[model samples]
Target: MPRARPPLVTVADVRAALWSLVSTAAGLGVAIALVDGVHATNPWSVLLAALVVGVGDALLRAPLRRLARAGGAVGALVLGLGAQVLVVWAALTFLPGITSTSWTAVLAVLVVAGVVMACGHWVLGARDNAYVVGDLLRRARRAAGLPRAALRTAAGPDGAGDDGSGPAADERPAGVLVVMLDGVARPTLEHALQAGLAPTLDRWLGSGSHRLESWWARVPCTTPASTLGLLHGTTDAVPAFRWWSRRLGRMVVTNRPADAAAVERGASDGRGLLADGGVAVSTMFSGDAPTSLLVMSRASEGLGPGQLFVRFFASPFVLVRAVAGTVGETLKELYQGWQQVVRGVRPRVSRRGWYPVLRAVTNVLLRDLNTALVAEQLVRGAPVVCVDLVDYDEIAHHAGPLRPEALRALEGLDRVLGLWEEIARGAPRRYRVVVVSDHGQSLGDTFEQVVGRSFGDEVRRLLRERPPARDVAPRGAASRRGRSDGEAWGPANTALHALRPGRAGEGRVLVGPDRDVPPGPPAEGASATPPAAQPEVAVIGSGNLGMVWFCREPRRLGAAEVALRWPALVPGLLASPAVGLVVVHDDEGPVAHGPGGTHHLASGLVSGRDPLAGYGSRARADLVRVAGLEDAGDLVVVSAVGPLGRVHALEELVGSHGGLGGAQCEALLLYPDDLVVPDDERDDVDGTRMLVGAEAVHRRLVGWLAQLGLREGA
Candidate 1:
């Protein structure tokens, strides 16, 4: 039998094709204006050139898209540029009016064309374009009987809801979706919205459906701690991002998969916010979610083919768009870094090295991945979804938190939020979107820059210096003077010697044990020097917060013992104007010593200006509470706030956190106005009233889920 004639293209297809053509033509016109050698001469000539280029693009679109998809984003960008160059060459060779000087000029034209195309895509809604393609691909796959199964199902405590069947579209329960924009402060976001950098967020706030409220992050405000608290409703023993774990016998970096898993185990109580069939994307912890993507806690497990990856890679153009987008973003980061240098923007850290590439990956590739995965979850009718985007946090770390580059990151996130809102409207279940941040960042110069030495170096100097006269006196005499000279004579003294082996003035203080430590029994006990006192003093910096551990000691020492061993240590730290508050375990309990001030946490007594005064009301409580954690440092050092609110970071970060001061603790939460806050109690901090702690934020989110009848009981 003869084959039936192919069906005619629909009106919608024709309209889409025309729109694509117009967009390409407009982009070509822009390229023509930008390239030096290319001369349009007149509006007619420009129009003619655009038409030729657009026709050529349309003719080769299918093959080019296939090639681009295979090559990924970077490859596609290169291919597109090459193709554009060839088209321009053909146009200049055949057209009468269009002219170019040389091949170099053609290359420039192609570059400009690529940039224009990218800009056009961004302006005309890039995510929307991807969404349309993804939706079509999904529908096509479903129709082919290759339906993608939902990765997880909601199960009540008794497993009553464990059936594989999904809720019908209309019968689907209301869901809550939380988007955590890491490291964005409430004030910073407010300024961005006022400055028109974040129009989408501004619109959301103005729509009356959402309300913007500021809350306080717990002490040692950081991603790992705040995220853990937000997800599991407890920060607990997570004192800092990286710390000396006595139990692990090594430093624990929170981003490391093993350490993250361990930390989550310590903090999670099995009933995380996403415990019941929720989805977590790009988060530090999985929140005990059944479906998780790029979660640090589960990163050790080999990633498998899943719905998110399937949906993300379904469209050939998505990968190409991501690559092209990353390239453009990388160029922008370089330009922004250069501009900062030219403008002599102070308090800015070096933006060289792999940072530009990292920023591109974060702002483009990772962002696209998160957005696609979240969209997939929404489509699959997840009960609750939580996604953390680190684009702003990564940028704000090197660049000042409020710099243009960081603000641009915020704008990009706002665009993603808009996309999610659009997707949620047609989702199987009604979703109430909430935007929150793990913690805010404080901008400042690093302590090393201001003090001419790192916190570790200074501490080493104190350890190397000869003990005070009282410390060197006879043990009985020292005891009479209320000093325990034991630290100077015991294993701590051996650690000091190990730390400064080549005499006090010759070698730098040992930050950690020598990497070349002899293997296997130290060569038959060849004068084994007490295992060389590995990490005599562990000084880990979490933003502006500094944690110092006297590692040689078997157990944590109090302030008196520390003073007796290294008398100049506390004095030296306090001498530096950059040092803010130093909290240590004293005989009386945890005592916070600030510049010319001291506060006894146990008694709630202040000797000088209340050290925790401007740090917020919960600051004292939070600091004391964190100090008591088993993993907390022997002495916790917080950077002093300058007159302009800048805090000196312990690390080499310009924008710092992990301690109180300024916007570091001031996080924001944007939720639907109809959602009820769990506590709603005002925390008065130095006369400023606000919500305190990520734990409260967690409760509020859980309450929202409960209110939607998604939980076991409302």
Candidate 2:
């Protein structure tokens, strides 16, 4: 037999535990209720988050107490905060389906809540040793001024070079260099320019080869949508990514964004939908296809846009982590391999700038940049080279886009861009550079703002109604009556058996709920009548994705449109202060409109040229000419308002794009009048045209190439 163990806890322990529980319960209830009162979330969602927190807290109490005694109060606080961060981070990462906002925000909220609870221990003096430790750590951190410290510059690899002799340039350029900027909204750029924050662009414009005007952006205004427009030069309405699977004929929404592997996994899982005996082709995922990806015939022939997207990139997360781990190792190895490459470059530059926070993410960017840079160097390139930087979007999500830290990150990115420009300038006469952002940044906590307050009382009440029961033994019979009762309505057996059947014939109908069934003889001539119809009860609202009436009608606009158009709903919901954007699905697509900062609408255009100018008119004509009869856009609207939208106080996000009337919808055209390129010469060009602008420029470029006698593929 096992030895008997001493009692783990005593009477005093029990009392403390009980007090903690009660205090915690009360505090959590008040917090959640207040959050609800502020219209943070509907009653049910608030209750759920509270329950999770409560259970999580209970499970952690023992460790917390032990840590308090060992670490001192200050140490205990740090322990608690650390524990909370880990727990919340794991929950958000592993079970993202349950996460309403980004993991960063969830971790923040969890820490704040845990800290507030630990303060109770301080006031109660439940654990003095731990409190002291926590205080010490706090003071130490404050004294160190850790939060505001500037990051150090990172060292480059010994052989990493800017002289165009690096491995990135191993592959020769293929004449034409096409760079696609995924979310560049013209209005957003104009707003940034008008704000006077970017002076570099003004100079670029003054250099010529610039055309800024109303260029139609991709429909749905997503990365995929915009990218497709640039690649295929058409808006086919075939979504690049969607929750609905035609093969499975079902809706399968994911809590997390799908990477390249996930797309293939989905295809494999749905293999049952494939046509007879054909093995899955490897070439499909290898970027071997040549023609446009939008044509139905090509899509059916195993050349799909889905496969193409995956072929060009690896999983983003994996790339980031690998890059981070290799940095220290790579620098050491490179320094040993090449002395000249390390001559002026610092060994620490690899560890500096955005490298520290983005240690895990910088690898993919390195590969992407290296590939573009190297390819262009080895092969002679065309006149224009467009470079698309998507890191801004990713950085903004983890750290607020415009936050000082994020700006610092952007500065690092700008430096990298400068590096690329420096390399291209080596062959300046042969290349022209254009750099841009897809859209602007907005700030806000994603989750709490959406789920904090929503749903109607009427909807909730309707869902809670119970159905009535039927079937019982006959009553008032001698065989069924109890000893003390004379012909009682119920029997004296089990609780359920005790009930008796009501009157037959006329009483069966029960015209009103208040009316009782009339008593009747149990003979052959009588039959029970049916009950009258019950009135419909009002419904109470329950949960939503941030919209005012989500649960009431989640199916109002269908699912696919919602998934594509309203990505913010999943990441921007909050359960406090009732701040967030509302996404509503429509026949056209998911339409978002709310008070908080989010890109709920398409942006406007920005142009130095008149709307009625020559090329501008021609561009308009081309748009009308290219649209097919079946999938043609019904109406095109230009928002007179600039890309910058109104910013509300009490919200973190300052701006948004994609609304109906905004500057984000506009395009910047920089085609010099003297250099009108022919359409035939613009084969390497990507993205849709501002007909007048693009075609004119194309004609001009073609003419220059003709003067040089360069052929399409030569």
For model 2, the local distance difference test gives 0.29
CA lDDT, candidate 2, residue 500: 15
Query: Per-residue lDDT for 243-360 in model 2, tens only?
Result: 1222222211111111211232322322111111111111111111132221111222222222222211221111222233335324533442244235532211112232233322
How far is 517's C-alpha from truth in model 1 (Å)?
A: 15
Could you give candidate 1's per-residue lDDT for residues 1-714 as a string of tens digits? 322332244334455556655655666677778878777766667666667765675576556656654443334445655666677678755687788888987766655665576667778666333432345323322322222222112211111123422223234457888899999999999999999988767765765657888888888788888899899998876888766655544555554444566678878888898998898887878889887766766654422123235434433234445767888788888888889889999887777665677678778877887787787787777888999888888888878899888998898888787666545544556677888998898899888778876666666677775323321111111011111111011111222332332442221212111211111121111223342444566676777788887655667899999999888888789888788889998888999998788999889999987777666567778888889888899999888887677898876678888887878888998887667664456576556666788888888778777877866645
Score every model by TM-score: 0.73, 0.34
Residue pairs clashing, model 1: 73-323, 580-640, 617-685
> Model 1 segments beyond 4 Å from truth?
1-172, 465-533, 678-682
- The list of candidate 2 runs beyond 4 A from truth reads 1-176, 182-202, 209-219, 237-241, 250-387, 398-417, 425-429, 434-447, 450-714
